[model samples]
Target: MKYSTVLSLTAVITGYVLADTPATCSTTGDNTPIKSGCCPRDPSKRLRRSAREIFARTDSPTCPTPKFYGDSCCTHEFAKPTLDKGTFNLQCGANGVADIVNDAVKVEIVGCDTADDLTKETCILQISSTPAGSITDTHLEISTSAWTSTKYPTKDPASWSYTSYCVKTTGVCQVPLNKIGDGASALCDKKLYIAYHTSTSDGTTSKTCTGDGTLIPGQPGSRWWEYLTLDFTCPKTCDGWCCCEKPVTPPPPPPSTQVCNIGTAFGYADGAKNLNGNPVGPAVCDTANRWGWYFATSETSLSGTLIVGAGGNDLTKGTTVGTWSATITGSDITFKYDLYDDNTNGHFDLSSVHVYASCTAPTTCAPGKFTFKDDTLTGSSDTSYTKTFSVSGGTCSTYYLIFHASVNQQIPSTGTCPTPAQ
Candidate 1:
């Protein structure tokens, strides 16, 4: 609400004085008796008018001269007039308090029949005060949800079931005397009230319901329920800066689509089956590709260096063997890695490997940050094997390496065993 300043009257004095004993006036106009009875005349023309005479004259009546209470000449007793208390009716204005001004404030239906049912319908009232102004007080009231001729328990039985009230105040509003001043006015008080009603259909069924309450003054106990009244006086003047409006948040941005690049390799190794049906390779063969050849592995080093080995048999040694190595790379949107076998000193073979690269923009092979998949082998034979491969690349955090290898046998009767079987 806007405020305007204007000159207001301070006080009004209405009455007249009397002259009885030729009083002397001081520099400041204090009436002091110069000579008692010096100007006295007939008793009927007494110098000072009696109280009755002063009361009879409505125009320019003189004020009564100061008289001592116990003076022999003055024994009149004056009684003070009594004043009547006043009552005021306050009603909710149209457009609610919002029409008062723009300010940051929250209004909600604190008491509702069913909260869930009102989720879609918000009983929220909002107000905005200018940066130069603030709402400092709020008042509320709630009437009976449904009126009943029957009396219900109430603090004030005289007003029971007829009406209920609630109020709240803050800041300057709490002060007994404070007016809305020019420039910026502070919010002081708020009052609210809700009314209840009932409906009957065909005089058979009666339904009672309560409507939303309105804010007003003079309701009982309304001063207690005002939800919030904030302090808006900023320590620093926000001359150019206005309070930010409550934000209307939009739904979160849609989930991002993910793209991946992958690459993979596989390998295997092979060796002859012993008389016990157990596969056997050289002690150094363990250092080399074995019957299960996926990647390099040593008793000392878990991940051994990749190597290519020669294959042949030492017949006198009764060892059957052959060695091979395989590697593959390609691009695909999707790829996976599975290990088929890990062998030493034998032929190495790899299943088809898949590779993929993904980018929101275009593909770039930045070192150390590229994405890719590694290979793993699960099964193998004495001379053959298989493995699974996976792809990695394109926005991947790491690249994978995969492979498989196997070995073939050379019979000593054929004299095909190389010296020491290089």
Candidate 2:
């Protein structure tokens, strides 16, 4: 049977079929319908409906109807407010934090039919700061009530209406000082989540999106689409907290070029009589009952060796204080000294303290071989003394500091001395 004859029989049976009528359809003998259904004229072609066409029609159409078999497709687009590609700048506030200037937060939106529909939608602007090496972050919402809408239905590129919100002008907005940071020219990580929703009961306001691209906890609906995260480096200079000026960093104060010319070492006596006044034989030079002198270098690690040369009429056995090596030129050097009384009596009767320096190690106490650096009298009430001398070429290098204490009193007849009264 012909295809047209079959389609005519099916169309007559059913009343609601939107597909185009084909030229013919197959039929059986005696004018009875031979085929169960009628297909489109071009089986490969399908019907596609755009948003405009779908909105224009009142009835909803489905594909593959009983009378004719074909594909029907319709597309519905969702709208959300997006940040305009226009300028967005940050300014310094009076509180020394970053703030949004007037009209700085610009949002462009479309697909709103009436002013009431506009009320159902809102765009959010958030400013936040996550300090360096900190996991915690703070957020602040700018005023969206000040958002003023201007429709440009016939714009050059495409039709889009923009809603701009001025932050400083409206009383609703304030500088988010904590979010923008507190110090001078503080840095803030700004996240502007322009969330726009269409549900009237959703109650989605500018606070709905807190710059994290997620709705407020437990709040319903996921219709928000547009989100923009801007990481703008705040400038050092801001014009009343509005526009960003280029940041200028003074070239790190030209690396300290001036080197230390002279190195100084200070020697401090523990007390008038060291060893806690504990009495012992003057010949005893053990760790206990000895006068210790603490030494430290002025210029960080002044490379040198300290030698406690024996002085006085009876003391002879010299001891090495310590040797210091510096990795960096101007490092600090320090050592300790234990002036033990090797004499028979425990009396540390000294005459004078002498500090000498030499480029090379010397065994004998010759004034000509070692250069005399400084001297301090033991009879003085001062318990501290300092030795200032020039280093080799004013650079941190190897040298020797020799300390000699001359004692005038002879050893007592007794083998041990009694502890002095405190």
Query: How does residue 298 of candidate 1 score in lDDT?
Result: 17
Stretches > 4 Å off in candidate 1: 1-137, 140-167, 170-422
C-alpha lDDT values of all predictions: 0.24, 0.26
Tens digits of per-residue lDDT, candidate 2, 263-323, equal: 1212223121122123432321233424423222333333333223322211233333323
Error of 2 at 284 (Å): 29
- RMSD to native, candidate 1: 34.8
Q: Model 1, range 48-144, lDDT digits (tens) per residue?
A: 5444221111222232334311111211112111111111111122333332223222222221112231222221212211212222223222222
TM-score to native of every candidate shown: 0.16, 0.18
Query: lDDT at 14 for candidate 1?
Result: 33
